[model samples]
Target chain A: MSAASLPAGEPRAIPTAFAIAEALRIAMASDPDVILMGEDVAGGGLRPEGTEEIGGIMSVTRGLVGQFPDRVLDTPISEMGILGAAVGAAVTGLRPVIELMFIDFLGTCLDPLLNQASKFRYMFGGKARVPLTVRTVTGAGLQAAAQHSQSLYWMTAGIPGLKTVIPSNAADAKGLLLAAIRCDDPVVFCEPKGILFVASDVPEGDYEVPIGRAKVVRRGSDVSLVGMGATVGMALAAAADLERDGVSAEVLDLRSLAPLDEDAILETLGRTGRLVVVDEATPRCSIASDVAALCVDRGFDLLNAPVRRVTAAMCPVPFTRVLEEAYMPSPARIVEAARALL
Target chain B: MTRPPTTEVLQVAYRTMRTIRSFEEALVALVTQGRLGGFLHTYVGQEAIAAAVCAHLGEHDHVASTHRGHGHCIAKGVDVRGMMAELFGRRTGTCGGRGGSMHIADLGKGMLGANGIVGAGIPLATGAALTAKLKRTGGVAVAFFGDGASNQGAFHESLNMAANWSLPAVYVCENNGWGEFTPTAFVVPVKDIAERARAYAMHALIADGMDFFDVYAQAGEAIARARGGAGPSLLECKTYRFLGHYVGDPLVYRAKHEADDWIRHRDPLRLFEARVTREGLLTESNLRAIDVDVAALVADAVARAQDAPFPDAGELLHGVFATSDAEGAR
Candidate 1:
């Protein structure tokens, strides 16, 4: 069923991140196994009281602390500690959703994700399960600078044990977060910072979008524009502009990055001879490059033209708004890149 | 004044120490001979810490070990034959031989793998303790790290979390005076790592790691407190490693006298022998019989490991995914 045919959507105009936080809260409320641990979750520990909210700077986890007082936790500014606790809790019985805060902070706490949690089940001879989700904010937008803004889902996707998922919209964010929390594998749920405040029609009832699935947002025949996270919005906008120009653009929203939907990607590419990848991440050795490589490796003969890429320049996400805007993938850039391939 | 351990506990501790010593020496020889192919961090000097701490633990209690973890593995009841086979890169081993010296794991006995990365095990132990707490299993999780790991950010973070949550965990830092080649004096400026626990409001204890009784007494108290929901504790065991950082280091960086003296005069195995024999808890003859039995076990493991076949080419991709059929087969 299409969006127009569906019944009236929920009245609440919730931001994507808040919707995801609500889903986690609902899961925590329903299941005692669900717990949340992150930095400054119960704020004002070190500082004077009444300074900030329970959750950290995002305020996405605002009321979770009061709702699930024992389960909702504020950890030290230690990603490793948070991730490790999640791993242990998962192995025993608790399903923990840990916020990494920023994907850039992975440098400090990657071992728990990579070495420990990732390898636990396999190393334990298939005896253990780490049903853990690490929620981190990503993408270069809002001028958060290099350290805060990075779409590092591609990096996590490269790791074997992790299931890296990047939700492009509010519904996907809520559904994917719920699915990731319930999955028996370690999932890196990256929330694009730009999309957090973006409003969307999310259902009221509990729903989950299966992991390792891609959504075909727009149907077309000319060229396929594959994108993830914030770039998906860019691709859709670019598709609208492309449609006016008589170029029917098929927009593929790659909801999950790790167990990449090679079938959906190849099928889209097969039907549409031209392909363009729009990723907010850096150009060289990125998701853009990876998707292009996959197309060449599998659907090489199907392509009518060389795969085009609209990605950030190979540099750090600058602090200035102009530079950050230049660094992020824009709808204009996606349109320009897709037109070139066409 | 420390009380003498029972005959059974003394035998077990002595067995653990003796097995660790022999296993490290054997692994060292194997590495030199090119039988084992990975980096080998031996638990030679820090035997008492593993022996005594594990004396209070059973299969229910869990432990997360560092790279220097053969002693911990044996003490925690991992099959010696499986560990040896894994070191030899045979598929019959624990972890299906995928984990070599640094990654040897036995989850059945609650020995979480020996981690290659320093301070990585601290948080894992904290997590295991959390799992135990949630399960209400009354099982304590122990983290055996080094003085080097004590300085890592994870070490501090995990200690605070464990203390705050009242997780049943005991953080043991085997202060062997060195981390890899760098001595603790160069890496850490503090007089004692245990003193940092006061910041987290956790009880802290320091013990002579070379003395089995010292480690045993302190570990017993801390473990007891954890089970009783008192909170987490930091137990810093002043220990030493007889061998170099890896198997082949010249060890010229360390003051020769310090290591030499510890090995010769302050050997935990020798000290334990003296104490147990002096107290008449066990005779020298009884210890000799156990040593002989252990030697045979170690020899058999090595022999079997030598004869064991390496995993086939097709087996490389296996175990990466826990398939439904495979999970059911187990």
Candidate 2:
């Protein structure tokens, strides 16, 4: 893969959605194999004279249809059908970035994800590589209720063959998305809809935050706040609050969940024995529960207190504004959990 | 689109049908003798459909198959020894013993694996067709599913998607009378599965699956239409399976006379040999030679498979991910 086709360097402030779009543009610019397929990936209906284009519901893939007309295919609303086809397309020569619309829709098309895409490499004895990237919206805050709003990265992470990644900021969004697209394995990229417009400085061209690594967004010594996607922002906010009380809290962004950055988790846990896991997903067998187990199993002596987990209430995501807010794990909740652990 | 197949194509087609017959008979013997284990859905009566359809495809053309897929694999040129080894759970199998009988695949030959899940291969084949369309490879993909699969959502979804995208794909429903114990008529409301194509606005064809010449002629038009970028088409073959759903099944649902009639009257291999011999297209002696050669080939495959080893313990965790182990799972 040559890097010259990329839009040249320099960091700029852009929303997470635009950052992901930039990553896609760079991938398509550099490699002709990268193609986009999904429902309304381009808002303009498949009519000849429809002048308007919504790009996507969130416009994460805005302007890509015109840039690469042949590559940005607007598929019919058949989730299982299109996803299965995308898996086929990936095993063949092309790299397909398919939009599942929402992570909740995974239930409708679990066969392609769990049985086909994830098992092809293994079942075919490593002869075929399913280089498919599923970019779906996750997390709740936008009143997009029970069906559209749960963060289910843990489901994909549990599957042995799938790599799950979620970025907390604009820069990581661009880099990690590019990494997911270019990687040769089937990657389920959880793009938290709650932080779609969260803006920060992102590098302009081709870059990759490798899929399995973690980023220590903020360093502290008293208690380590581990988070993923939107929860990372909450962890940072909690770190600021904890610092006011003279208790330095380290914030770790678990960008990739499947290749669960075990070494990084242990390193951060070793440095700060007290750990608080902030997640928007339910606590039952979640990433939070896994990390807490990882700490106890591997870094038992390093602990100064029992591990803490601040997660969403174990119920359906509510549509009401106040109920949803209460359902979500806020920065105040993270601080409370971190303080309890300290 | 319906040009008659050449004599050479007929010879190859006959050999393919003979090979499938020999392979399935060998598996039946093995299963009966307690040598083979698990679900073994043999392609006993439906050889002509796979042979006729696959003859029109090139090496790069892809084929996605269902549980009853050994014939499709052989017609698509999968290595017989590898397929045999897979069923034997040997190391040198097509999937290194990982997929077993239900999941033999050779992508290099464009044979997508025999899927365990019903109706899954429809979209995979459609995806392969989409790849051919995008990459400009001049290739087409074929999905061979059962009468049962047409009821699943994948069948409808893939048909609509392939037609909408104008992809190069041929969906062949080997309507072998039964959908695993129950009559296809009991589950599928339509008399012919090809009628389902009208919903997607796709072209449809029906062929006598037991007659190789008829299936070949019909499949030729469908495949040619797809290759010429005329869009997707469905070809339903009215066929029957002479065996039970799986090797160990009691087959209590269907009367013995029903299977006896199909086996006696409509065996695809017998029909193929009789036609070729009757029209002077091929002699009985030539067809007999093929029968002889196929038996030897199948016997050799079985011998080699029996001698091969199962994969080592370490390999269990090796291929769970690309170039990596199922990490952290000891």
Candidate 3:
């Protein structure tokens, strides 16, 4: 369903970050077992008499501690500690939604997610469940520099047990986050920093988007433009430009990366006979290459031409605005790739 | 000094220590015979630390262990037969043959897992304690790590958070003198790992790791404080490992005399037996009877583990996720 057609109580316009915060609030309110923990999640722990809380560096967890003060905890600047504790808490019956602040910091605390949470169920012979949600900001264009702006969901998605999802807009942020928090398995909810302030209609209360399902945001019968997170908006923009040039482009927003929707990719490939995979992540071993491989391996006959991928350069995300702009994939790049396929 | 433990507690402590010693000794034999595969970090000389500290924990309390964690597992009341089967890579094992010695776990018994990565369990235990505190379960979580793991970033981070949040966590550093092949002193400049606790404003306590009574007394205080919402503490147990870091190691790092001296003079099992017999707390006959029973139990576990079936091929992809369509695809 389109954003305009969502039910009435849904806010007409809400920032994507606030939408995620709303999801956290809803999750904590729904289950007493749900808790939130991250650095600055509750702002300055020992604030001055009348000073307000900072919520978080991005304000995604703002106004949460006010409602669930005890559950929304402010953790020390320790990604490893925060993630490891979340895994421990999940095993011991608390559903903890932890924020890693930035995806790049995953290097500091990846053992908990990679070794512990990902292997718990399998290693324990199905006896254990780690219902943990690790929320982090990803993608370039915010001038967050190399350390903070890189998209590393591909690394987590490469893992077998962990479920990785990225929302294209505000509504999916709420639904997918709620789904992730309630899911029995460990999930990595990636929020694109570029789209954090992009306003869109978001449902008010509780809702869920299935973990492995993809949504075709736009329908067409020519080249299928595949994108996720911030790139979905870019793909749609490129599709609009292509439409003006008498070319129709179908845009698919891949919500989940680990349990990839192969059926959707092949189905769109079957209809369009051409593909352009757009990703904000680097070129090698990314979702774009994955989709390109999927088409080559399974839907080889369906492709009228070789699938094209519009992805970021292999270099690290640069700090300067000019270089950062050059680092990320643009709508023009996506349109160029789509036209090349056409 | 704390009051002496009751006769029953003392007897149970002796039994656990004896069982750990017997189990590790049996593993040494198994490794020699090439019956067991993979890395084996035996807890032969350091049995008293795990046995004594685990005595204070119940089923509701949780503990995260280290790579050398069989002693902690047995002391925490995990099924010896299942643990043995796990070591042998059998379907009936605790992890269904998925996790060997370094990864055995029983959530029902509150043993989170025996981690393979150094210092990884510290945050896990800290988190579990946070869960207990937030849920008001009155449960405490203990992280049993080695001296080498004390140098890890996770160790500092977990302790800082535990202290900051007043989480019901107990950080137990099983200072087995050696971290792998190297002496802890070579890597760690500080005389006492517990001294690091002062940075976090946490209570720091040291214990004779070879003495079960000392460990029990110190651990009891820390666990009690945590359970009572007094925040976390660090209990550094000065102990030593009898064998090499793993089964196949050449162990050329330390002098043979160093190992011989510890084994002869400071063996935890020997110390326990001497103290209990001298104090008239337990008779020689009683200790021997318990030892006999433990030997039989260990033998039976070995027999069962040998006879247990390997996991079916169909079971390969199971248990990766609680629910996923990708199961068995690989």
| Per-prediction TM-score | 0.93, 0.97, 0.97
Q: For candidate 3, please provide the TM-score of chain A on its own.
A: 0.96
Interface RMSD of each: 4.2, 1.7, 1.3
Count of residue pairs whose backbone atoms collide, per candidate: 1, 0, 0
Across B144-220, the per-residue lDDT of candidate 2 in tens digits comes to: 99999999998999999999889999999999888888899888788899999999999999999999989999999
- What clash pairs does model 3 have? none
Docking class of 1: acceptable
lDDT per residue (tens digit) for residues A1-342 in model 3? 222223457367877887887788778888999998899988876899987788888877766777787888888788988999899999999999998899999999999999999999988878999999999999999888989899999999999889999999999998999999999999999999878999998867789999889999999999999999999999999999999999999999999997889999999999999999989999898888999999999999998999999999999999999999888898999889888877
Per model, the share of native interface contacts recovered reads 0.53, 0.74, 0.85
Question: For candidate 3, what is the DockQ?
Answer: 0.78
Per-residue error (Å), model 2, residue A270? 0.8
Model 2 residue B108 CA deviation (Å) reads: 0.5
Off by over 4 Å in 2: A1-9, A45-51, B326-330
| DockQ-superior candidate, 1 or 3 | 3
TM-score (C-alpha) between model 2 and the true structure: 0.97
